[model samples]
Target chain A: MSEKVLMKGNEALAEAAIAAGCKHFFGYPITPQNELTAHMSKRLPKIGGTYLQAESEVAAINMVLGASAAGVRAMTSSSSPGISLKSEGLSYLAGSDLPAVIVNVQRAGPGLGGIQPSQADYWQATRAAGHGDFKLLVFAPSTVQEMVDLTGDAFALGDKYRMPAIMLSDGILGQMMEPVVMPKDSIARIPERPWAACGHGDKREHNVINSLYIEPPVLEAVIKARFEKYRLIEEKEQRCEEYLTDDADIVIVAYGASARISRSAVNAARKEGIKAGLIRPITLWPFPTKAIISRIGNAKTFLCVEMSMGQMVDDVRLIVNGKRDVRFFGRTGGMVPTPAEVLGELKKIKGGI
Target chain B: MLTIVCGHYGSGKTNFAINYALDKAKEGKRVMLADMDIVNPYFTSSEYSGILISNGVKIISPTFATTNVDVPSLPASFHSIFETNDEVVIDAGGDDVGATALGRFSKKVKEKGYEMLYVTNMYRPFTSNADDSVEMLRSIERTCGLKATAVVNNSHLKGLTNASTIIDSLEYAKDVARSAGLPLLFSVVPRSLIDQLPKDEYFYQADVYVGTIWEKGED
Candidate 1:
């Protein structure tokens, strides 16, 4: 049996990256997510891995892009404002179709928001992480154990799809501590990238990793292929957790820190003779549209709970397509809505209060 | 009996504190695990609230330690730990800033006649050598105004830790303990590596009972 270890979310993610066979880490220090960089600095060196604290988040992300092109599992992590700086690098990574892990331990945003946990970056991560006609495989982890498991999964999925994967976490998940049963003596085996830019030598012809095409039609063709890949991801990658939605009349849709609190609220509502259930989106990009569509049968109304001002609520409304009324309850600017607050929203939706 | 654990950051003070409290509770001692960390918001013993409550070990930490609030405020309820007759374990924050918070309770801790243990992961930045370790210990002592009663070897490679890592850190830890004139109480070993450890070495098995703030349920 694997022994459980009490580890903080950031430290666990750093270790998870190491366990996933990541040999290179490049990141800049930022609040709420700085522990991750510190942990990587300590652990990466012991394993003969490279841990470079880049001058800026931009420089760090570009370094990850370079490492990925060189055919190595590399990663970079930061909080909200830092992630925004990495946006251009992300677009390039997507355009170049390189696989690397990018972790965003989210904090309140809009511009140097407080260093508290918030899910305001939901749109930024899922809708358009970087400016381009591209999509990323975003994994949202609600628990510290999930932070470990999802991070490893992000690497796997990134390598499988040959694109950047965002491990979307909040300050809460990034800094909180949890008991995680690590896979004992587990070694990650990511297949060798034949197209890596490592010197071709005499083995084969030189491989190129570039996103630039001056010609309009060539760029269009390349973009078409990328969308085809995204279509497959949308079909196979939608992940979520549904709790008691089977016989629920009201369903709460939330993710990340909000979902954990929503679970508590669901349980509280159930004890009050109200049939409240929760649907937590594990992968925000693929969005879990099918899960919401399937739950419309028993659920008459849906409440979207977020730590942001109705960011994910749009997705819930879009997925439901007005079949049922979608209401939103949020606490933005680093304010975390408690179970009691969520339960009050649930009662309001059900007209029981 | 009161046992307080203090150390620098990345030194595994939280881990040693949790395990020691659990051990005392398992032995039928009324245990209270109090988190004296008001400095570092990211890591603290307060995250183990559920596990402590489940194991019948009481906890006293800042009410908003797990929240996003950066307020360096400690609640009045914290002083109750000193008033209780139960065995209390204080998990002090790392460095002088963290130790300063522990300094506030040192008078009460002294009045109660408690034991303070300074944990060290020699692999940490400043404490990589015995001299530096002793120096950091003195800094902690100066901040807390109470001397550490013992030294615990908790050295590891953060997450890439293995049996060899533990074995390698033992000598360095012993050196630190010797220089500081403290007993090398016990080296903390991950449970999985216990059987693989050298039988001659003294050690304590630590089952990780804490997780990050996001981990919210009882283990």
Candidate 2:
């Protein structure tokens, strides 16, 4: 067994990236995610990895683009507003089909949000991480250990599909400290892709990496092929955790920090004789539709809990498709709902019946 | 096993609190890792709550303690610590300013007669010498109205760290304890370096919790 070490969420994510063989890091210093940047800055040079604290989120993401194009494991991190600035580069990365990792330690926002934890970027991460007809595999880690585990996996998955893996962690997950066990052997096995923008060196035809195609038919084909890859990812990469749902009547659906809070609520509600269970989506993008749909038969009602204004609940509502009554409870503007508050929500849901 | 862990910022108080709680819980003790860190919003015990719950440890914090607000949200529930008989581990916020919140419960806490542990990393700024370390403890004790019964040696420079830093801090830990007339409870050493150090010393084999990424990879 690997000895477990205590680590903050952001630090764990950075360490896991290094473990995954990521050798280049480019990021701007932002609240909540500073630990990750600081950690990389302190350690990357010693390990012969490149760490650059870019001038802006724009420069940082573009730096990742340049490194990833050369077929190197690279990443960039920022918060909500910073992510907004990196959107153009994010779209570019997707267009070029370059593999890398992007971390968004989400804070409250529509415009410069507070420096505390918030999951308000759910829609932005899942629906439109970048402006284009593309999808990034979004992983929502609820614990520090998950942050470490999924971060390593993020690189491998990004490499597998030749696209970026978006880790949507909020401030709560970014700042908290916990005992974490790094994987025994987690160096990502990156296969050399022929499409990589590396030196041809007089061997075969020159390979090009670009997202744009001026020819209408060529662009349509490129977009169609990207969708095909996304389709496969959705089918194979969906992950979630189900707790005490075997005999549940009312099920609570949540993700990330909200899921951890809801876990406490579920345990408390069960003691109160309320058959409440929880469904925590590990992968937010490929939305665990089948998982929730399977539980709809045993559950009479579903309560969607989030730290945002009912963003993920919309995805749940779509999966339920009017089969069962779906109720929503959310707290926005950087306010995290306590476990007692979540339990109270469950109690209210119980009373409505 | 109710221990109040207090220290200056970057002193590794939160890390020590987590390791101690997990150790007690693994020993079959029902642990309560309470988060009284109402001041610093960046790092706190509330984040490890999920893993702690899995280990059968209960966590008690303010309604929105980890939420994005500067408001001191601690409620009257601070008195609930006296109600639990489990191994209660209190993770106080950094410095005297943060430890002042503990004063509200000091009366009941004193009546219960618990041990207050002052954690120190001699390598951190302003805490490298004995006088500075003792002064930090005195201020925290005055603010919380509680005397520290022991000191934990948690000194390291992270990536540049090795067994020598921890060994060197043992003398610093003893000096602070000697000045405060307290016991040198235990020195924290990374588990990997444990074999190289003398086992005769009072030590807790610590995980490399506060180190950088290059310092990671040991299982």
Candidate 3:
């Protein structure tokens, strides 16, 4: 067994990225996620990797795009508002079909929101980040161990699919410390990108990496092709964790830090014989619709718990399709909902059921 | 007893200070925990103000702590800690940048004759080795304007810390203490891992407080 060491969520993600063969990290300083950048700055130079603090989030993301186009695994991380500044670059990455990792250790948002943990960026991440039609492979990690595990997966999967992947974490998880067992062999197998802009030196035809397709029909064809890849991802990469949902009456749909709180609430409800279960969406972009659809048979009510003002509840409601009562219970503006409050919400739903 | 804890970031200084304060409070000594950590906005000792206050432990946190603000503002002056006849535990911030706040109280603390304990967790980023740990201590001492009197080996991997983990870090901790020319005070062992070790006065058994929201029951 590998030795388990305690690590904060942000630092663990940085280590996992390095282990996944990510040699280039360009990021701007932001709360909660700054530790990841700090860790990268400390560790990357010793291993002959590149760690750069770009002037702003925009520059950091473009740097990631440049490195990824050069066929190197690159990453950039920021908080909610910082992510907003990088959204245009995100669209460009998707349009160019480049592989990279983008991490958002989400803070409370709208405009210059509080620095506390919040899941308010669900809409921005899943639906529309930039001004175009593209999807980012989004992963939500509830624990520090999961943060370590998914960071490696994010790099690999993003490279495999040729798209940017976002690790949608929150401030609570970013700042919290937990024990994580690292991968036994830190070295990872980096896949070869055939269409990279890295110089071939007359070995083969020069490959061009660009997102500017001015012709409308050509752009539509390109977008449609990308959609085909996204369809495959939606089919294959929808991941979630189901706890006690096999025979549950109330299914709580949550992701990231809210899921951690919901898990405790589910246990408390189970102790009180409320038959509450939890479906934690590990991949937020794919949205884990299969997990919710399968549980709709036995689950009488679906409670969508979030740190936002019911952003993810829309997804849950759409997935449930009015078959079951979809309710939302959230505490936004940096206020975290306690397990007791969530358990109380479960009991009220149970009583109604 | 004026015990000021300082260390690198994530070195478990806050955990050690809390347990030390609680231990002294339980011993019927008047304890005052000054949460002087101004760097980190999260996971500070000020978050446990209710529990600390209820346990008869007077707590003084930085201004705007536990609020929505991230500004590192200390009190204009500290009077209660100097005035009271209580066993004081000042949890200083991490690294030299965080420890700069401690310089404000240098003269008063020096006159009071205090033991500045430099906490070291070997698993942390910068202080994983003796040289780095010693450099960190010297830098902290320079910024804080006080000399550390002893070394605290609070080395553990949070919840994954086993008896072997602590035992293996013995020489590393001793090396840190020796390199710093400070006496090795004691190694902190969590309450669960106490039985695995042979009883010795060098072990300080402590309950792991100051944890995540999910790990509430463990503390």
Candidate 4:
């Protein structure tokens, strides 16, 4: 039987990681995300797992790389600047095809922006996290429950594809306390990893995990093979949460905290006699572009609401392909656009004035 | 003059405080800059340690003693420096922890007759509206047990920042300051966009004019 428990997104993530058999966690503390490190610090030791508050984000991510190379489930987390430091390590992980989980409890930034929640990292997470010809599986969780469930999925996908999986979260999600139903024990047995480096003796060949491919052609082949795996991920793992879309004239596209606020906007719009709906992307990297395109022919307009200045709007425009008028409503630097504010934007788009 | 710069993350608080410390040092004042941000790894005032030190600004940071910079303990000397220095600037961590830490030093600061500025970037989270800004200020006050002396309206969107966005942000910040019973200290604008803004905007509100100094010199 599933039981409901009150949890923060960070705690949910830690629990989910443990449930997924993740045994190593290396991170630096940052506000709106300290709870994650705190939770792991307490829980990991109990389960005989490893948790280390690395000296810096650079050190933390490199530690994750070490743990991953050693064939174990490993994870790391930070905010914007810390995430920025981890980007280089992420690129290395992707190049080497090593599986690991990286959580960015995104805060406002181009620099040390703020500690308040911001979905500004949509571009950073969905695009290459660093300078490279590679991609990471980026997942966006809207609810605390999804934070728990998707983290498990991230580990499985990371191991299956032999690449990095990132949980793109924000301060609001990390700090907000909510009720979530923890997964049953029976549901946790799937996706066992045998490829992990727990040490193989003379029974097998030595495995050296490195991103260095000196020859250009061989590197090109490795990249091509990684792309093939990404294609499979895209095909099999495009996740989205659609709300009140049937018979709606307008659709609001958002993810994470913005999605929660957008839900309220949809409800507010419906009360005002506007048929507005919401489509929330669960996976940001394997963006549900096809799902959006499929509905574009029917919806009259689409509104992209985010905490950043039109980052995800670009993706909406790409999917709509001029099929419908696309509008944008956003708040940046950790400011949450209220439900009423989003409803106001919907009213403008729906000609309800 | 003791100045404590407080703001949310990415609000340019560190940049402003660092420059202010540098400006004071240029005037030959014995300036001590204490970085209380154990949160952000990049772009803190202490990140420019070399330049600040070379320019005769004393720098105190989490990395000052500990190899583990993420969760560094504040030194006991941090409190005494405020009493000794002619002008000391405290750059607190972002949000809750920063506010809480700054609050702990409030009595010492009050004793020293220091000025605390609550920096607000109108484009930032929880500060976009007057109500939200007021709420954040109240929370900060609750955490620190001291009210902010002034409000700094330093608003901008990273990369896509423009003059109009700054104006819109300032408009909201003006309302926030008025409601919170604090004077508007200044509005921070990028050096490139500064030319586009009307002089009147700064004439009425700003006590100081500033620019981004992160890329200015060798750190």
Provide the RMSD of all predictions against the true structure, rounded to 1 decimal: 8.1, 11.2, 2.1, 15.6
DockQ leader: 3
Provide the overall lDDT of each model, using Cα atoms, as 2-decimal numbers: 0.86, 0.83, 0.89, 0.78
Chain B, candidate 4: TM-score: 0.85
lDDT of 4 at B180: 88
TM-score of each: 0.74, 0.70, 0.95, 0.63
By DockQ, rank the candidates, best first.
Answer: 3, 1, 2, 4
Q: In model 2 chain A, where is the ten-residue run with the lowest total lDDT?
A: A1-10
What is the lDDT, from 0 to 100, of the residue B154 in candidate 3? Answer: 88
Question: Per-residue CA lDDT of candidate 2, range A1-353, in tens?
Answer: 11445566888899889888887999998777877898799789998999998889999999999899888999999999999999999999999998889999999988876877789999999998778798888999988889999998889888888988899999888876655677643456767877767887878887787877999999999899889989888889899999988899999999988888888888888889999999999999888888999998999899998888899989999999999999988888877787778889889989988
Model 2 Cα displacement at B219 (Å)?
25
How do the residues B1-219 of candidate 2 rate in per-residue lDDT, one tens digit apiece?
569999976678887888898889999998888888876666577866777788888888866765555566776666677887788999998889779988888888888889999998776544667898889889999999999988888876544457776787777888988987898889887788888787779879766443321123221
- Residue pairs with colliding backbones in model 2 are A2-B219, A3-B219
Which residue runs does candidate 1 get wrong by more than 4 Å? B1-39, B42-91, B95-115, B119-147, B150-219
Distance from true position, residue B191, model 3, in Å? Answer: 3.1
For candidate 2 chain B, which ten residues in a row score worst on lDDT?
A: B210-219
Instruction: State residue A218's C-alpha deviation in candidate 3, in Å.
Output: 0.5
Better of 2 and 3 by TM-score: 3
lDDT (tens digit, per residue) of candidate 4 on A172-275: 77764455666653455435546555676767766677889899999999888888888888888898989998878999999988888888888878888999
TM-score of chain A of 3: 0.98
- Compare candidates 2 and 4 on DockQ and give the better one: 2
For the record, the alpha-carbon RMSD of candidate 1 to the native fold, in angstroms, is 8.1
Q: How good is model 1 by TM-score?
A: 0.74
